[model samples]
Target: MDNTFDKKHGHELLKKPQFFFGMLLIMSLLGYVVAKGGVVSGIGILAMPIVISYVYLIFAIPNTGIIGIYILNFVAIGIVRYVKGVPLGLTIDAQFLLIYLALFFKTFFHKIPWANAKNDLVLLAAIWYGYALVQLVNPEAASRIAWFYAMRSVSLYMLFTVPLIFILFHKKKDLELLFKIWAILSILATIKGIAQKMFGVDAFEQAWLDAGNASTHLLFGKLRVFSFYSDAGQFGAAQGHAGVVFILLALSQKRSRRLKIFYIIAGVLGLYGLMISGTRGAIAVPVMGFALYTVLQKKTKLVLMGAIMGISVLVFFKYTTIAQGNPTVRRMRTAFDPNNPSLQVRLANQRKLKSYLASRPLGGGIGSAGNWGLRFTPHTFLANTATDSWYVMIWAEQGVIGLWLHLFILFYILTKSVYMIMFKLKDEEIKGMLSPLVCGFFGIMAASYGNGVLGQMPTGLLIYSSMGYLFLGTKLEKENLAIKAKEQLELAQCNK
Candidate 1:
């Protein structure tokens, strides 16, 4: 009777389409909310659809469809943006809501069979939470809103999005589809950046600066190209990362000549976008990402050669008129000058932070530093403090303990990914698939030394999504190998 009941339940689970359809319906409703009102009102209305979907998925689909909903919502928003003329800001807000809904729904699907927690990416999440906990206890940083803000940022950008993309996207075809979407959007963004550079009249940039009462002079004499993203910094960093990824992927493809050519074009356009944004920090992304790739491939000689070549190029650019003639190039040169007012100010701020953090070792709390803290949690230590670097912000807000955990998580992910590349897989296509992600991790890590790319949407999304793919790829590879071995054994037994 128990076996029959189990079988019946399983059969019913397999037949469930309502759960999936309901999820799409909820996403459509959320899309409508975002299209009508902005993010604030949209969040208020998001709950009902989420609740209804959750309940339906729980009783109907055996596998929690939260991740599916998240992806569906992402694709839906893209569709809405293309079809409804919804503003990027509104779309971003809607994406945030979808992320929250996905997280909430994931609770029901948390027990679904997938990759283990020891996976490098999962360890990264653990490290992130550990830092948050430290921030929670620090007296100097006891701001509830700050915690929520941190949670909101991390949850929406990394923790939720990455896992969902990895778990839900099971096929190579799906991965290709996602990459294609990413490429198309990225190319569009690059075109916008190029336009901004050429004619200094981007509606998005002007609107952003006017709304914030901020000036673009801080971006140096070069025109700050924002594209469709929130700021020039984010735009530049994202383009830089995407440029490298596209280029690497293009180089990796053993087939599809036309697609390879398109990728190469996309990569060049992306680099142009990065350059026009006038963010000197953006340069580090490709350097670090490529360096990581070389190191992981056990090409120590290649790494050393690349480093020497990079130094040579830097020296040439510095001494030659080739870079000086270019507006973007001239602006990037400012980043190297210690006497540059911005650099001086950042250094002074770091000194102040060092003194402050020395006594209050536990930190002020998460989201208590940078623009995020000022806007979201004004009561925390860094709410009024100045922290230019992401690492400094983490150190000031969460202290040494928090910083350690964060680093540990990143290192853990790096180690695991490296192991997978080195030992686990021999397939070139699989290696190519993983390369961009590994490079992205390195790029973000290096970029974070100067700016906070880790928390921002594009970079964060890329990181988590790549991490998810890494985890899933490793798991699938192992499963396939196991099944193949089992099949061989069964065939041998039958032959005997």
Candidate 2:
């Protein structure tokens, strides 16, 4: 009698006495849990049935699993603050893997367009992953466990995400939906950050701050609002990334007015989150993103206007202490200051790493730098060193050879995507839609110099998705053109 039953799942099975008994058993268990514990505990027990339903839904519809992975990527690390002891990060891995597992079983009947994922971008990701794999036997590697954990961020996510996007989620509609989801999450994050700013931190957030996070988060007197992200630095960078991407979308004349307004709202709120975050490094995201966007315009007047605006803002921050009263502005200005103590300290550390890594062409190996190094080998020299910059982490961990390879891959994507956007794509609308991906990619790359934001959660996955879609430029344009042609043909026939 359950409306949820389908022929595929055998609705007739409900006629059997065993089925009735099974339903009664489940109901009795739920009731027992509610009686013994409380509503919250009963709800927790219900999760098993819900999880089973979700598992079945994802196996039946692989795209839903992709959505699960995307949503989880944004919230996974933050979930740690609430849910203690569970390896929530692993769930992100599991979600994406489920998508592929479903696809694997499906391959027995359906012929998947595997060739869609064949491209330089995916190849480069594989090559980077292969490099990490090679680091397993790195002579200087202090911990295999470290390599396993660090490599997930370094290469594994990219390897997993890009191919999945190209093969499964390459449609224009899918891309638009992804961007809209991004905006919604960003809006929610900012709302959380604003609450933290206007009122105060919650119990969980306060506990996080008390547990040594206060050192970095609590500046002069202002609390760097981190929202639900791992830290203020990540929150600031991610918000600024959203700001750049959405503002670009808002500027697109080809998009609908409703979407444009939504993009504007998300963009402004994102910038607000960036301001409250007090992460000086994140300021680079907007500065560099807008600069790149202006140049991409290739119009003299627009470039000149952008330059003028850029200079005015730079001079205001660098020369005049106009907003010195404001903590956010004050902290951001330090990024431009050459003699700032923290910058000097970071430079000093880089110099030390340079001298240490110069002798070893292969360097300290994967997980030998950053938090992983600090954890697995606290007494080691590199472990004591802080890799403030993402590139520096790669250099310290992977050495000059690996650094060169990494740079090559990134630059190749940036330059090639630019060429495709600038020349290869015909439709102005699609170009506008895709332009933000390149701009945001550049912004994150530039910001990565100050903080290791690029390879971190959400940003890394998003970038890999961008790379996938950007490479699908020609195909997307064809689809766009087809739609336009159909519309025009309809109009002509209507005129007749």
Q: Model 1, range 337-390, lDDT digits (tens) per residue? A: 667887788788888888878877777776778776888776655677767666
Per-prediction TM-score, please? Answer: 0.74, 0.92
Q: Report RMSD (Å) for each prediction in the order shown.
A: 9.5, 4.4
How does candidate 2 score on lDDT? 0.89
Which portions of model 1 show Cα errors greater than 4 Å? 1-111, 114-120, 155-157, 202-204, 212-214, 217-221, 299-305, 319-321, 376-381, 476-496
Number of clashing residue pairs, candidate 2: 0
Query: lDDT tens string, model 2, 33-136?
Result: 87987755665676778878888888898889888887888888777887666677887788878888988888898987788888888899999999999888
Sliding window of 10 residues with minimal summed lDDT for model 2 = 2-11
Evaluate residue 406 in candidate 2 and report its C-alpha lDDT on the 0 to 100 scale: 95
Model 1 TM:
0.74
Superposed on all Cα atoms, model 1 deviates from the true structure by an RMSD in Å of 9.5
What is the C-alpha local distance difference test score of candidate 1? Answer: 0.68
